[model samples]
Target chain A: MKLSDMQKDKCVRVKSLGVDAHFLNRITSIGITEGTTIRVVRNDRKMPVLVYVRQTLLALNREDCEKIEIEEVA
Target chain B: MNSIALLGQPNSGKSTVFNALTGARQHVGNWPGKTVEKKEGSFTYKGAKYTITDLPGSYGLTGNSDEEKITVDYIKAGHADLVCILVDASQLERSMYMLAEFAGMNVPSVLVLNMMDVAEDKGISVNAGELSRRLGIPVLPFTAADGKGYDRLRDLFETELSSPHLLTSAPNLAEAKSLKEQGEAKYTWITQMLEGVTTTGSLDYKMSRFDRLATAPVLGKFISIGVILLGFIVAMAICMPFMMLGSMFPVLMNEPIANALTAIHIHPWLVSIFSLLIPNTLYFSTAMAAFVLGVNLVFGYLEEKGFIARTAYQFDGVLSKVGLQGKAVAPILMGFGCTIGGTSGTRVMDNWGQKMLAMAIVWAVPCGSIWAVMPVISGMFFPWWGTLLVCVGILAYVFVLMWFVSLVFGKKLSPVETRTGMIMELPPYHKVHWGHIVKEAFYKAGDIFVRAFRTVIVISVIFWVLQYSASGSLEDSLLYKIGTFIEPVTKIFGLGWQSFMTFLSSAFAKEAVLGVLNAIFVGQSSLLDATFHAKTSGVEGMALAQIMSQTIAPAEALALIFACTFNIPCVMALSTTYRESHSLKWTARVAAFYVGSALLLACIVYHIASLFM
Candidate 1:
């Protein structure tokens, strides 16, 4: 599922960053990589969404959030 | 004496450690040719003195930003005898990444695990001895905020020192790893160290309870607005006393002071300068000083307490829509206080183009000087509700103006970079020490006062000279001739010539707008005109707005107020804009654009208000 589509507070493991390489590098440098755990702290339509990854909070726009591929953690 | 620099990410307690060590002996300055601050201080330990530099914090030492570039350059130049790397103990997995980056530099280093108490509270334990063996450096758990473990920290610099070796090439790492896998490889190595040397006492993460309500994606936006509005009101309220004292200057000056000066043998020109120029100057200087200081104190406290990061996080999407980063919210909000301070605040932005574009948009927001005079002007003619309309109207206009300008200049300025997402670690909320806040407010107010005084005084003296001209009494002064001459051109924007003159002078200082209106209206109107009440009446400061409303139609008054608020800000802001951008072409172009747009908006406001009239 796309990261932005995840329900609030649901933990997910990142699959692969489906965004452009430039964005992928940035996300990686910030400690987000494949298999990392992320939780959607908040996601609202018409507003920026908050994601908690690796003990840091990141605010991503809908477009950028859509580019991150993830799977619900069992 | 040897020198060592303290380096860490923001909120990693670098400043705490610096204060713990140097305490009151620090000298602060700016990096050469950059806005980033350079802080250095020295202390003596065991008969040996050492100099300490606090490097600006950054996510990593990349060429992505000025702070990063300065960090790398400072290290490569071999300025530090040893680099004391500070990391948050509770967030080691992520904070240690900087240590991983530092390993490539081959500089001698020591790791100070700051916030050790917090780490213990989180039920985490880091085996410093074993981890030190793996990374080929000494690691010590520390709580810098309390000056705990100072002995161990100093010993690493003093006696336990070893020749630092490259940490990138770990002994147990597989040889197959390539250069590209350096980050992953380091993490893998760190994970191995964690396996043996660390014990996770609990899996239950401790999160701030306040974060839930504050970061609620939808509600958070509204909360952020409320917080900002509350911030504005509190700041204004703090300055209320000074503003009242300043308001009394007009009465105090023209009556007792002016009469006494004339009663003495003081020259009339000197008397005119003192009576006309000095009172307004004192009034504005006091009012402006209070406003800037209050805004910085309030906002700076919030930022220190970590509320600002959540605000940036919550508004990331909204900010991105306007072609700015989430962090840009800080400067834009601060622009309401003082444009110069706001422009300087953008130093944190790594992208030069985005910084420049943000500066452009900030000017469109009416600044604190305008905010000071706004209620004063509107109170007489505008019902309180009408005044609220203008306040809201300014906010609405600024946002729309941002949208329009973003479309026009977005691509050219902030062309998409690789930073699709930001990493914002919101530090735990805490009370700010007011001593530092007051110190900062003092510096900010001092800077604003000097800059405002320089620009306003020069322009005011010129205005005074023109008003008391050799031509004749006030009717034949140079300003009267100029005001009447511009009637045809000023009429296009629905501003009477006198109003036009005040608006023009406002570009030098918005705080002077009320004073100019009082002088010109009192000078020009017939003595019998009861409404032109400033010079001839018992009531002094509040009479300008009433007289203006009575003399001009509401639409024209609205037009004049609209134009004055939206016009190019003060001379201080102009020079500051120029200084920040350092591009004469961009500065002139932006100023020209503001003047043009302000007039267009004024004309539109005038015609719309006229329909109702």
Candidate 2:
């Protein structure tokens, strides 16, 4: 399922990130490897989405999330 | 000793990383021929001493912007022993494009995947080993905020330092020849490396309907105006107590100090010296300085916490109403902190048209120093709404100025095709640390005090001499005479010699007008009191109002507005303009525009108001 389709505060694991190759590589270079768990903190439509990744909080826009593919783990 | 260059895009948390690595021991300098700040700090990590240079962040090294050129030149010239590129993990694809460019440079480099916490929370994964193997460099995942991976980074540095032979070969002629041919290969390698360790997932949630509603054209414009109104209201509400505290502090500190000094049976000259130098002007100045300093600290804290940015985003539509766009937003928002700082930030806009527009608009937004004086001016001179009217008038004036600027120098907005993207990293909401706040407060206070004690003090002493030498009174001194000579022109603004003199003294420093006023009316309690005291005693005691009443009408409020608007640029702002723009021509233009427009506006307002009143 698409990561943006999940409810706020829900934990999930990555299945695939659908982003462009260059963007995906950049994500992986930063330790956003497959099988990592992420939790949605705040989901503001049209604004950047806030997520908890590897113990740090990050805010990204819809354009960024659209590139990424995800699955529900919890 | 090995030198590492820290390079990244703006707002990539590079500075935070630099601060975390080398606290308080850094030398900040301007990049050659550019105003972009260059910071260098040294630290002994593990066994080796490393000097770290924090280059100004750029999206790519190919851009024509001064920052990009500086980064590209420094790296190509082999100034850095190791180049550490800090990439935003959240925006990896965009970042990788720049990474590929770096890979082509054939320089020894390391990749820092910052904001890993954010990346993990987004359910993105990376294979660090694979990326490192493909890139032929060590890749470290770091949450720079919490000191994670810093030790591993240090170890990597030490390892690289000990084995200097592992340095990447410089770009060879053959490789340069194959640049076009190998571009795709390099990209493919990066893609495969990314795919090896990364899994993508779909987002389970979509943007809410309300979020869409907020950005709708008509609704967004209204929301934008509402947001700005709220910011103004909050600023005014907060400033009330702030000003009260500021005004009361001088009285609280001055009287007791004066009384204690008075008790000492000393010569009249000694008393005069003590009273004049200690409890009267200088003491009040210090108190005001402290107050201004405190306000700056609070605002700076707000800025660092991203409150100001969020506020700007909320009101961005209203800002666009005045011809301000995304690039211009930051500087205008910063005007709330200090106009000098805001003016300096204009250099960040790469587009010449945008930079000029931002500069012109920044002057319209009053800084905190002006805001601090609002209540005093309103309560003493005019009605309760006076301050609000002045603020609204300034905003309106800015709107018109922006329109005029666009009409003259406006370029077609060609969809703004540039690498600059506004994906601001929002940190989790956290309580502000008082330690950081207080430290920032002291730094700002010290800077302002140093400037006053150095430059403003000289101007004050010169004015003191002029007032002392005049036979009639200090009010009739040479400085006042020159000011009075311009009284006829100023009369349209309803200003007499005293207010005119205040405007003249503002050339030295805008706040100096208040200082000059205090100097002229030290013993007198009020404008009315001063006038009465001056008339009863002698020519010397005649207050500025008494002088002004002879030349200009008392009912003309527009004259005062004109004087406020047309006066010389504040000394601090002048200095900031010179430094930031690095051109005497721009500085002169700013001064001429302010003074010329002010005089013209004052005359028009005076004539219009005279006909009405």
Candidate 3:
């Protein structure tokens, strides 16, 4: 599922980033690479998705968020 | 002196460390041609002199942004004897990505895990010895804010400078074709090196209570407005007392200085320059400096405490629709305080095209000086409700023109693909570091004051010359002759000679609009004399309003208001826009566009209002 579709407080791991090399470098440099655990801190509609990853809080607009593939962390 | 370069991502406390080391011995300048600031400072350690260059912060050495390219180029150019890479100890998992990206650089380096205090507060700890052992380089835990571990930092620097240690545990990725693959390799390398060497103790990965309100979906927008309003109000409060004191300068010293210069048998024009011209300009600069200082202080505090970033994130959705990113709102907010501040504030944007676009839009915002002139001028021409309507009309048109200009200039200035989606870190809230805030606020305020004073003073002298009259008759003055010569053209926009002169002089400084009107309509000898008389009599606003109302029609007043409000903000703002945008063609284009648009708006408003009058 797209990371933007994740509910608040849900933990997930990045499966793949469908973005190009430029954006892929940007996302992964911030520690959002594949297999990194992320918890949705705030995912309200019309707002940027706020996620907690590796002790840092990142806010990504929905368009960027929708390009990230994620898997439920069980 | 031996040289060192400090590198880190934004918010890694690199500046705090630089300031702590250099103290007052820092020199700030641009990096040759780029607007990117180059800060260099020096300190003596163990009887040895060392100079430090604080490289611009970047996410990595990926050469994506100018900042990143500058950092990588500087390192590759071998200007530094040692490279000090700083990472936030509190967020090493993310912050160390810089170090990961730096793996292949073959430069002698030391890793400073700064912000150790914050990490300790969260009950996280790292074994520096083990990490150092694993990475094959020196690592030190540091708290740059509290001045902790500086002695050790110095030792580490000294040791690294003497016998540089390149990374042995990490593979050099210079041969890597794609940055994505290099980033993946680096992260994998970072993960292996950090294994068993760090502990994140029960880290609570959640937004704080205040942050919840700050980022809440629809509600966050309202909260951001309240917060921004509150911040602006506080800035105004802090500035009012200083501005009031500044206003007293012209009243207190005008007569005495005029008498002294005249008594000294000085030329009347020379006397005017000293008595009337100097104090008036001083008063203006004082008000500008105090208010800009307040803006820097309050907004600096907001930015430091991390609230400003939240506002950017909250507003991204709305602002993006207007062909700007969330970060563009910062410059817009500063535009309400001062256009120079707003123009300079565009430095925060990473994209140069976006920076230029933001500067162009800042010109459309009714600046502080316009706000000061508009309400009183509007009140003179219309009733209370009508005055309020004009004020609201100006604001409504401000947004309309903003969208209109963005539509016209958006594609050429900022390409669609460059609207790179927002991917930013929302730093944790912390106490305001007063030392850093005050130092920065004063530096920015002082820089702007000097530039603004230069522009204001030069223009005031020219205005004095134009307003000079040996016969003391308005028509005999050069300003009147020239103004009337152009009156035929200006009247097309509903402005008489006096109003045309007012509109022209306003390009130098908006407050000068009133002085022009007073000089011509209120029977003052010159612009300088009018400013002095108005200051001493303390009835400038009320008196000028009454005089102008009788002489100028309500329709013309409405036209003048619209024209002046949208004119190029000031010469200072023009120069600042040029300096910030680094594009002479764009600056001239924007200036000419504003002038044309201002006249067009006036012509339109005047004709429409004339039908009713």
Candidate 4:
């Protein structure tokens, strides 16, 4: 499943990023590489995920989430 | 000797490291093609000298921005033997991405994980040895603020110098391939490495209740306006007492000094130069300088304490309702005190379009200098309501200017979403540092004093010579001829030759307008001393009043307002603009725009009021 498909407040390890090559590179460069655990901190009304990556928190739009490949760890 | 380049995003504590190594010997210069500062320093570590260049903080080495371009170019060109990538430990993921980019550069580098304390506080743990093994480089965890890991960093640098090996990694390739699929690879390769080590866990982050309410559209707007107005009220409450105190000090000092000079039987010219010119210039400049600096320091303190950012965020919510946002709020808030000061602050805004728009409309807001002068303009000629109306008129003009710029430029009016939600980390609240404030006040005052002593004093002397040489009786000199040339223009404003000369001098410095008036009437007496006595006498020591009473009707106060508002900016503002924009063309444009608009508006306002009055 894509990381965005995970339920809100659920922690899951990232399996693979299925996004377009450019964005995947960018996100990975930002330390969002696969095999890392990510927890959904909040979800907007539109279900866009806001996640904490390391020490910094980020809000990713739903459209951007369609490309993130992940597995349900919890 | 090996050279190391320290690179990281801003606020990463690089300066602390630079200070620790070089002490006070760092040389700071503006980076080529960019206004962001470049800091370079050298120090001996382990008996080998190492020179380090601290590049401006950047998120990545992509050549998208000027700062990024410089960092990338310097590294790619082999300018340094090793690059020390300083990553904030607390913000490891974000820092890691940049580190990955550096790794892709295939350059020898040592990764220094700074801010370790903050990371530890947040319950985040990084196995530095494991991370180092994975990235194939030495990883040193440091807390630059407290001077931890300096020796380790030095040792790592020395070890890297002994055997310089480039790490080969396409760690970002999979993520790159996943994201874009085409693998255009505009960015360097280390972005791949970042993908392997970073992970996030589900956590619920909620906006504070206060933040939510403050950003609520309607309430936010009301609160924003109130906050801004309150800022103005607070500034005035603080400034007025200081202004009065400043006015009193000169009066007290000048009278005694003037009397002492007279008792000594000093030559009249020497007495005039010493007692009147020097003292008045010094007092007025010092007072105004102190006033401006005091207000700025208060704002700075509030900003340092995080109150301003909180207020700005609340205001941002209000602006969002009106389709405005970002750093534009700072300039507008600054406008409440002084349009010129607001214009000077435009450089701090990161958004280019916002900077230009803010600069264009800043002058439409009346500053304290104009505010203080307005009462003098209206009381002698027009009613008090006229002064209020002038302020309102300027506000309307600014609104119209803002609208025009937005429309013409097709600039998008929307709330700016900051990459980081927090404006600035608020320093721990504490008692106001009076020592720092006083030091800053003196620093600012001294800078202005030096400028005045050098430029304004010379101008005063030259003007003095011109007026003395052109006419034996101060009536028929080149000063008068120049005033005559502008007299027809001044007549519309109820001003004669003297007022015209004063208005022209205003271009040099707004206070110089008062200075010229003093030079003409006080005739070598200290201008501040004259102003003090004039205020006591209720004439306010403004020479324009005497000229107004002699030559024109009271209705021409509108003309004087126009002249005052629209005249060229002071020398400090012009120099500031040049420094901020780093373009002579823009500076000239700003000056020309103010001068032209002032002339045109003054003409229209005078003509319209002339018919009715």
The lDDT leader among the candidates is 3
Q: Which lDDT values do the candidates have, in the order given?
A: 0.69, 0.55, 0.79, 0.57
> Could you tell me the C-alpha RMSD of candidate 4 in Å?
7.1
- Which scores better on lDDT, 3 or 4? 3
Share of real interface contacts recovered by each model?
0.28, 0.11, 0.70, 0.26
Model 2, range B457-496, lDDT digits (tens) per residue? 4444554444542233555466666666877866756666
Cα displacement (Å) at residue B326, model 4: 1.2
lDDT (tens digit, per residue) of candidate 1 on B506-578: 6766765766676666544321111111222332556666567678888887887888888888766776565
What value does the TM-score of chain B take for model 1? 0.74
Lowest-sum lDDT 10-residue window in model 2 chain A: A22-31
Off by more than 4 A, model 3: B17-51, B147-159, B171-181, B200-204, B337-359, B383-385, B404-415, B531-555, B571-593, B607-613
TM-score of 4: 0.69
Q: Supply the global lDDT for candidate 1.
A: 0.69
Clash numbers, per candidate: 0, 41, 0, 27
Instruction: Give each model a TM-score.
Output: 0.76, 0.65, 0.89, 0.69
Order the numbered candidates by lDDT, best leading.
Answer: 3, 1, 4, 2
- Which wins on TM-score, candidate 2 or candidate 3? 3
Candidate 3 to truth, TM = 0.89
DockQ of all models, two decimals each: 0.40, 0.10, 0.67, 0.21
User: How would you encode candidate 3's per-residue C-alpha lDDT over B415-475 as one tens digit per residue?
Assistant: 6665677888998886565776677667766766676677678877887788777888887
